[model samples]
Target: MAEFFDNYGALLAQGTIDTLVMTIASCIFAYVIGLPLGIWFAVTAPGGLKPNTAVNTVLGWIINIGRSIPFIILLVAIIPFTRLVVGTSLGVPGAVVPLTVAAAPFVARIVEQSLAEVDKDLIEAAHSFGSSNAQIVVKVLLKESLPSLVRGAAITFVNLFGYSAMAGTVGAGGLGDIAIRYGYQRFQGDVMLAAVILCVVLVQVFQSLGDWLARSIDKR
Candidate 1:
């Protein structure tokens, strides 16, 4: 046990950190792009505040196209774009671009769904008070949807975690990389098992925290 720990412990620790960095960075960037897009989607739907069918249809098709691409394929296909954005496509930074790209559309959909669930009565009440679209969005739609948004964030994080691992297969450098290198290439079952176990634990932690946070803030 000591020999095993001494041989691979630091590698695992660094891999975990890299995975986290990729996941967290990807999550932040994905939300940055997705949140406003989602608000636009909800606000411009047929029965929405603005009701521009053309804008919604175009955006919907774009998002659908983005979401339709599998991450691995997207990862390879976007190598040039990723390299242009981050200067390389081989590490934590490199992995983030594709992860963000892959996740943003999904995040947008989640946000749209959450905001769509906001009580129409609340929006009507806001409108009665002469609230502008921006005010209603910030003060009413977003406020009411905070819990669901948090939950969605957690889901996004978990997904990015998996994506980060997959990125490792291509030299993105994380637990996935470690698992592939030591566990698979070197035929070390123990190393692979440890990496898998750590991944499971991290996922559980993220999911539980998300659920707890959503529950704590949910008024309904």
Candidate 2:
């Protein structure tokens, strides 16, 4: 055990940094793109406040196509785009491009679903008080749906965490890369074990924090 730690401790630390960078960066991009798209989706669906079938259909199809592609294929297929965005398709930064693309649709879907869960009565009440569509959405739908949105964000974050590790397969430089190179290729069981344990711990921490935040925000 001591020998194992001595050999791979530095690599493990680096892996943690890589994983954190990839996950956080991708989540930020996902939220920036996804939240607006989700709001649009919610507001344009059938019977929605702005109900535009054509726009919603096209946007939904695009998001669905993006979500359907497996992450591994996405990583390889978007190499050119990734390179154009980050100048390389194999480091933590480069990995963010694909990870964000892959995560956006998921985040949008989650956000839309959370918004959909908002009580229709609340929206009606806002409308009855002469609130504009934008006001109703901003003050009624989003505010009431905050807790669910937080939970969705938590789920997205965890999913992105796993994807970041997988991105290491293409030299994205995370715990996954470390495990693949030193553990699998070099037959270092200790390295693999440590990486897996670290991932588990990270997920647990995220889950706990998410639950706490969601509960705190859930005034209803």
For each candidate, the alpha-carbon lDDT, in order, equals: 0.91, 0.90
Each candidate: RMSD to true structure?
1.0, 1.1
Residue by residue across 49-167, what tens digits does model 1's lDDT show? 88999999998998899899998899999989998998998777888999999999999999999999998999999999999999999999999999999999999999989889888
Q: What would the TM-score be for candidate 2 when compared with the true structure?
A: 0.96
The positional error of residue 148 in candidate 1, measured at the CA in angstroms, is 0.6
Residue 154 CA error for candidate 1 (Å)? 0.6
Count clashing residue pairs per candidate.
0, 0
Q: After aligning candidate 2 to the native by TM-score, how far in Å is the CA of 3 from where it should be?
A: 3.2
Query: How many Å off is the CA of 105 in candidate 2?
Result: 0.5
Where does model 1 exceed 4 Å of error?
Answer: none
